[model samples]
Target chain A: MSSSSSGNVGIVIVSHSSKIAEGAADMVRQMVGNAVPLAWTGGDTDGGLGTNVAGILEAIEAAWSTAGVAILVDLGGAETNSEMAVEMLAEDRRARVVVCNAPVVEGAVIAATESSGGSSLAAVKRSAEEFYA
Target chain B: MHNVNASRAANAFAPLTASAVLVNAVGLHARPSVKLTQCAKGFAAKIEFALAPDGPWTDAKSPVKVMRVKAPQGATLHFRVAGPDGKAALAAVLALVHDGFGEA
Candidate 1:
């Protein structure tokens, strides 16, 4: 949320399980402190194990930054839903949000660390995606 | 004898280097790894870390790679640094490790 002032890229973690989403967020906070804007969303509208596009959209809004936002998803469903959420944003905003293909927890941690260092949105996404490479 | 001479020659051109024992309780876990990488990124010098004198070094500025090192407490972290500020970078990293990443 405060990332707008910092001008650092924001991050959103999406997972099927609420616990995993929150836990990954906790790890990112512990490592990166409050330097990077971060948010997480998981589970379905009914609080079941699933991905919700609306929740992901709200999280993107909560963690939005002019610098851009990087989203990390745990599975196929989460990735697809995150893409949908990005599409729902205005065309200008949609271009700045990216769903990275990397391990969720590790990617979030690395991405947050890079963002804390005043890295650009593209750099942040690259750092997160580097986990797979 | 030839091998020993070759090793000596290699050392003659070695980059700036330093080593410090990890004194923290948990070693290079998430928190310390993040701290280490952050510090390394602040300097322009290229830095690498290895658990042994001859090792598979990992990029010190990459948090994910540094975390993968997983150097345990009491493990000696050997660093190889290059660039104009190599000395300063090595000192800063050594200081961070010597301070136990503020965890000890």
Candidate 2:
């Protein structure tokens, strides 16, 4: 990883469909380039319309950084699974990860932009949540 | 390049203002809105955008808010920027719009 991308909050997109997760990740990439670490996970292990806790955990790790990680979910299941994934993290890592309550796609894009600008994890989460406010 | 009309406020605390036409084919769609907000965040100014001269202004630094503006092609984008870097913020935003967000 380049030094510029370090310290920026990471982002994870969680959705019931893999396509939606990937699509939101694509938008974040297009807008922020490689300025922030980003990852996405969706669908069950069976490749159906559901979210997986293990997969979400892996995504959180893939996009992990010391600055922190913000997860955006598509629906209730995605959110529940995301919370479980966070719970599975090591105690220290758990504190740095949060499942935000915001629209999946829009929240991911806005969160990634805030992350790219070197905002704190809380600030990024607040920016994404602004959509719902 | 699009024409930009910039003016300073009579009150020192008042925000600097500018207007520029969205010349890009898709106007302030997803991509352009992201670019605008990203550009706006680079400065220390508190920037707002409105479709009208006196609006219903939206925070220019929030991607979601800016995207919600949905300013269409040829629509005028009015900006009100306040802060220490207000002048620079207004100039950068106007330049981005005039450049059609590099999509023209």
Candidate 3:
């Protein structure tokens, strides 16, 4: 309900395959409804299997909220790219983002759900991290 | 641990308890699990769920714990709520369960 507010935490999904990233976002959207902010970016800009910091950075910016954003990446390169993307953010913004260590699909679900519930940044990150437990 | 949160309840207003069967073809899975966990969070009650009439009850508010019950079709889920809004919380969850989570 308060998602539009700055206190809302958003989710950014990154993967080597654009389909995988968008598909996971779609499933999370269905579960949490459209209220929770969500963004996904994957694949090379040329439409191949790879990741780019530019795309991942755009997703982080798009998902920005006062409550911060949690990143879920699908592969090793995606993870490294996501980290770089986080660093690209303004110092203040960078402090609010985190690369969650969990399965992308499950992490997206849990993060989106907790964000929809109006959880804090740390709480949402914890929920995403808990997916691995 | 039953008495761990005893003092949290206002009084012995009669905890609401109910049992429902899972009728949906896939039974308890991701979708239902999400819906159920969201439902459990709507109230201040401490909700616990059991797979059978006399089974071990775990916190229903936890998605992982709820999914661990492995409630297949025809499996009965027992829910118990204790708090000021226990009755209403129990009824809301029972209604969701009886509706097959709208998946049947």
Candidate 4:
């Protein structure tokens, strides 16, 4: 509903704790300040330390943009669920989603900044991957 | 703030050098590093940062490399700038560095 988050590359954060996912998103919002679209799903739909495929899918949908969406997960399980969400998307949407290989907090922040600059899918993912460097 | 590698104009006369002391309690950690990297990307120049004035400069435009420095508080980061908009890029990095990244 905000102009700041519209028309930019989007980001989805997946974490085992709603606090973490939301916190990471908030931190990014602080740094980038709504310059990029951001969405997140934490824990299970039941509010446990698990990821929900449907929730992940919905989060991705919330952050969707033609510029592309980058997903960052807190752990392996979150990663798996995120992948499933991508698979569950319509073929057209699936093509625009990428699960990044960066840590959740750092990756989300880095990716959001890159997205705010209106970068492409590959470039945002590349910046996230550079977390290890 | 010492100059390790002397500035040489990559073109006719636009090379620049700047320095800033890391003042945050943890040095150049996640938030600060990310802020610096984002600032570095705004220019087309070839900019680098290093702990030493004379050796081992890393690309300013790379978040990974900037994070790799693990520059702690009290460490002074020196910058080398060359190419188009090099002077402007150097000034921005130096200012951001001095800003302490809004950290304690």
Candidate 5:
């Protein structure tokens, strides 16, 4: 976790397939800005049926350095992958990382774009609450 | 068909807030439309969607109401739910749209 205060909101959405991940991420970028960083994993690139942790880790590092990081993942193995990522982070870094359960792929971007001036965690949480409640 | 214009219907709920994207390549056409309507049926919130004049506000739970709205591909719909769990319900609708009716 780099200590830079970019105040930039970063979101990474993981899916079993890169297409799904890219689609959701692109949809969000369309709503927000074209510069949102995305870390795509899984599918043929990783040659697996689930998300690739290495790719996700790289994304996390990028997001953390730019601003805070929010993660949205598809259910099932994707969820497990996100959880594992959170566990791997240091205590302080873990605080900056939020694994959102909202319709994530869609919700995270909506929340991130909508947040504007709040912490990345707040935006992701809002998206999750909206999805949950 | 059932007295949508009735005063009682007007009094049935209040305004709510939510966001959703149009799923289904055809976008708000058939089966999924019914699914959305069905999901909203049990709620008393007065759901309304906003897009363009072509896509006017409609009840979230009514198949007929949704059918009349004509939300198309990639259209983003903002909903106001003015009843119980209205916010939550609206979020769900947003998810459905974002998911492209789970087709994505």
Candidate 6:
């Protein structure tokens, strides 16, 4: 979604650990009640990690097709992995990849839940950046 | 105590050994698992866990394995360390769990 209109914002949070990822997601779910799209990549290398590059891309395309806005959060290894994945994408898709500045748990949950008003990926990242600042 | 952060807790892998303490507290399930995994980040080691008192230990860094032990409040879990800096990491995490995260 563009910044000028009421578009959906997809939010991602990466934590240094899987528990933090799930905790962050749980916090947001408690706050926002599942209205927002959430994805997590914790520090685990298991198959249950859910959203990786393929999953993230699929989420992005889904958001773009459905909501036209995508926001991603990567904590710890998730950050490096997600970034690497984004780098492998085309310019158009890569443009949508925005890493957040918020702490893995609190900041991420807060920013993602509060995201509205046609928030852009940059805006979400800005919120995350300011979250840490 | 030092504030726990993502970067500082990385790659500090440890192993799951015998535990004499059970993590006690309400709703205190996943937080420790998360902490353990996060603490394992950035270090050049691996982390795994096992239930204390005759439970099998699994990958400490794995959220699923950590949760499987279900080290609920008042439940003791064991930890082991087998990599670089494993001793220090094990000490730190064990202390955290032993203290019930300062809530016990």
Candidates 1 and 6 compared by lDDT, better number: 1
DockQ of 1: 0.50
Flag regions of model 3 displaced more than 4 Å.
A1-7, B1-14
Best by TM-score: 3
Q: Which pairs of residues have clashing backbones in candidate 4?
A: B4-B53, B4-B54
Tens digits of per-residue lDDT, candidate 5, B1-104, equal 23355345545656545566675688886445545654565455666676753334675654444655677887777776666566777777777677776664
Chain A TM-score relative to the true structure, per candidate: 0.95, 0.96, 0.94, 0.94, 0.79, 0.68
Docking class of 2: medium
Q: Sort by DockQ, best first: what order?
A: 1, 2, 3, 4, 5, 6
- What candidate 6 gets wrong by more than 4 Å, as runs, is A1-6, A47-76, B1-104
- Which TM-score does chain B of candidate 6 obtain? 0.64
| Fnat across every predicted model, in order | 0.42, 0.46, 0.08, 0.25, 0.00, 0.00
Report the lDDT tens digits of candidate 2 across residue range B29-95: 9889878877887887778889998877788888878888889999999998877788988999999
Predicted candidate 1 versus true structure: per-residue lDDT over A39-129, tens digit per residue: 9999999999999999999999999999999999998899999999999999999999999988999999999988887788998888888
Clashes of 2: 0
lDDT of each: 0.88, 0.88, 0.82, 0.83, 0.62, 0.53
**Judged by TM-score relative to the true structure, which candidate is superior, 4 or 5?**
4
Worst 10 residues of 6 chain B by lDDT: B1-10
Deviation in angstroms for A58 in model 6?
5.7
Per-residue C-alpha lDDT of model 5 across residues A32-114, encoded as one tens digit per residue: 44344445454534466677666677668766634567788787877787778777888878777777767755465544443
Which interface RMSD values do the candidates have, in the order shown? 1.0, 1.3, 1.6, 2.1, 12.5, 12.9
Off by over 4 Å in 4: A1-7, B1-14
Q: Largest DockQ belongs to which candidate?
A: 1
